[model samples]
Target chain A: MKEVRVFAPATVANVAVGFDILGFAINRPGDEIVARLNPDITGLKIVAITGTGDKILPTEVLENTAGVAAYTLLKHLGKEDLGIELEVHKKMPFGSGLGSSAASAAGAVVAVNELLGAPLSRESLLYFSVLGEEVADGSFHADNVAPSLVGGITLIRSNESLDIHHLPVPQNLQVAVVHPDIEILTRDARAVLSDTISLKKAIRQTGSLASFITALYTNDLPLLGRSLEDHIVEPQRKQLIKGFDDVKKAALECGALGCSISGAGPSVFALCDSGYLAQAAGQGMQEAFALHGVNSQLYVSPINQDGVVIL
Target chain B: MKEVRVFAPATVANVAVGFDILGFAINRPGDEIVARLNPDITGLKIVAITGTGDKILPTEVLENTAGVAAYTLLKHLGKEDLGIELEVHKKMPFGSGLGSSAASAAGAVVAVNELLGAPLSRESLLYFSVLGEEVADGSFHADNVAPSLVGGITLIRSNESLDIHHLPVPQNLQVAVVHPDIEILTRDARAVLSDTISLKKAIRQTGSLASFITALYTNDLPLLGRSLEDHIVEPQRKQLIKGFDDVKKAALECGALGCSISGAGPSVFALCDSGYLAQAAGQGMQEAFALHGVNSQLYVSPINQDGVVIL
Candidate 1:
């Protein structure tokens, strides 16, 4: 119970068709981190947080997701004197719609649980990251966190009870991640959405959401592409992301199953049949963003099946 | 080919939360028909039509869904001289949420296709049935026909290419069907609906639709229950189906996963985990309907994975 390694997988939350209710965990490799039971006198502290720098905020239980997760563990186990430190490999980029913060929180919790003989159930431990999410985004939504903690696709469903489910990830499915060098804070991105949308539009949105999930389980690529439509949020948020339409069109033309803004914005994710097509879609998307004077790194990988794992 | 036996599975269309886009084939047995090839000279001639004569229209190209399907296939194959004699055995009750007509239409087309050596893929053959639905419902919708033909769950994404898919059915699932004697025509059921719904209401509808599909994939029953809500159509339509609220509440009280009007329905569907619970839900629903002076027949069955098949 001295040292442990837990990997948190990246996730796609608010997948185009299902805004808050749908999410999937990519089988692609994600952030890896090591958490150790340090014999320090600090009340939940990080010795040296790797990957992200000064912008990651003060490593205090109040501001840090990993710190919060550790604090929660200590509080639950009635071990206030115990100190823990997390070293995130940051394999998945932070703020890339890949549940970056959730990774930190989930990785911390999983590591601590492993270090302490794993007492809590997987769903029981997921709340720590969800609480941490409330710290940054006023609301505790777990579309990204749940999937990041437990691999495969996860759905937030109702905010109550924090239902976490790990769905099946179809084989050979690849997802292309393109992170544009732009930032649309989750809070800001959320604020732009309309409080009330037309019912016709809503039903159609429901249709698309149903179609998308159906397509995923049935492996209907074309249906998945068509189902990745957001009549409610995308229209309002697309203006926030420069050249979203052109980029999406480019991805589709390049054989991407579908393309949409990942999470709140800036980063875009596209589903493709093969790694080559995914890579092409990613590069094409990056180039389209360049047309709008935006440059970003492209992460071309397969779907992340092994959600959170220890390296 | 002298004899052709084709199968179309029973489908749950207007899937509680998903009005139009979501549908799934039940695990129970469905419709089956045998169409023997007969050489004739003129337009589609249904040499024989039997089973559920009360609901089925005569062999008219514009009225009978079966005739329409046969005609569509004959036109596509460019063999107007091909005579088809379809013998349909209706396993599902007419006017039930289960796609009874769609089953017949899909079965007929598939049987004909087999008799003709199946020149069209399953996806292409679905169009013939979908085209035939226009004869029954006055609109070309594929939600019912798609699942009946493809098996599993289906999503009618678009009419252009007839986007349909068979999604994965959740593990440990069963469905309870309750049909009231009071007749509810599809046209009348649609008549009660408000033509235009608010944008916010629309998004909520989409959320529910997303919720049902998400719940199915993740196997989150509670989430699925939460998502079994309708904002636009159900509210208005419920006024016509007496004891709707009471029956729905009774079914839910009896551990029913979710309950709603099945397709422009007077018939209601309740999903349950066990066959006993399913039967209980149906009986409880009947008792609830009795309070409103409406008598109903309840069918407790599992998800019919096998679509239409030959007898």
Candidate 2:
């Protein structure tokens, strides 16, 4: 095929409980990437940047997540000589803490794979996706990238092997996402966090994360709710987001099982048991943000089992 | 119901990846407690202490684990005026990191429950069991008591509400426990650990723990093996056990999935997939301890699915 298009779903990184190690993909707002094989072009080129957050995205091939992802894949395959044109249509908002960069990176790799007649496996593509992410953010963490590429909830075992495990998504689970009209750079949010955590708090986080995974497999809502607590990271990072406490309280009051900042945040997410509660929680979160003079976007989605789709 | 006898199984607390939250019951070498309701006594009394290592256990009613557990349960049930005589038949070695005190505590409370018309529920029993542990160890932790009372693998949610959850035990899993002739008090082992850990290390611990729980439900042996790692506690506490590194190496080389200090120290347990491997691993662990001029006792048993039983 001369051309291919792919859509990489947005992912909720950290998921409140397991920071830097856990994330889950979600449908709705995601990034669409179009890759075209062009023999006339000498190297990978960023053809266009469109959609909701186009103004913020870089059209330069070296700087764009999509372009960087395409280049990384071709280089790894020893086909860097191949010419490719890439377009990133960002359906999700930029710096929204919804894994927008990951979606763009994952989408570009998937599209490039399809354009090149499919040589790399989905697991292999994760390496290039992470490399793409490194160009956008200065680290090689795959909590978001793995889920955006592989779908469902993921645990990044180690960055060395890029080992990723897909955890079971409980049935009837709903996700309430609210993005406030504010930008908190991932670097800035991360900078606010302390380098060290008390041993007692660390042990609690380990227990909570383990419990959260077990709850997913057993479909125990109460345990899941109990396990969604983060004593280490959220307490530090929550300060970066405006009205974070109010948004979280509103969501919890609206029947969210748990609430916390999604990824590194200006955005927040709540886990609800039912779709009705999810919608209500989302509205509650938005209203809470509005009370602080912060307008917000809301998305109530089922746990997205399938990640990137070729459309 | 005037006289009741119960056996609470030994538990492997910490379980490598989860420091203060995870534990599993084992079949053999537990505490056997006999509780008798004698109106003539008018207060709790510790009548006897016997078996492997009884010299260290307290004989006084207020100081003895079994006596304290009985007293706590009776006081909670508003039946403190009822006279109770408790006998602690310590089948498990004391100060061995095999939950010896927890077994005595859990067994005594269970026997007292039977003798007192069985009014207390299992969940309610955890509160008193923790209180029982406090008498022996000076802190409230239910990782051992919960599994010993409730059976199988258990997670203690909160000490306040005494909320506990039982996790599914893999059918093919075996536990290889080796107790070297060394005493490492829980308080001392815990004291060696630092108050804080780096955020980088904390995140790794969380991922490992989550992987461990997921492995149990999925029966993923390799994942379980990989997840049996402790960056926070084991590294600091392992020094308390003689030849700890050699013992762990022997167990791992003998095909055990993972190996670490059972609870606090002195005793080390290795997880195995087969009974044959469990036996081999147990022998290897014993030999490793023997090389350091330490006598050791070995127990190879399947993960005990049933905790305490009435006799």
State every prediction's TM-score relative to the real structure. 0.80, 0.96
lDDT of candidate 1 over B1-311, digit per residue (tens): 38887667767787767677777776554677778866653445665555665765566655778778877887889975666666667766776656778887888888888778888877788888888877777888888888887776776666566766566677667787777877777888777776666654664565567667767777777777777777677788888788899999999999888888877777788888778888888889999999999877666676776665544
As a TM-score, model 2 comes out at: 0.96
Candidate 2 docking classification: medium
Candidate 2 error regions (>4 Å): A52-60, B52-56
The per-residue C-alpha lDDT of model 1 at residue A293 equals 92
Best by DockQ: 2
- Candidate 2, clashing residue pairs? none
lDDT of 1 at A194: 71
TM-score of chain B of 2: 0.96
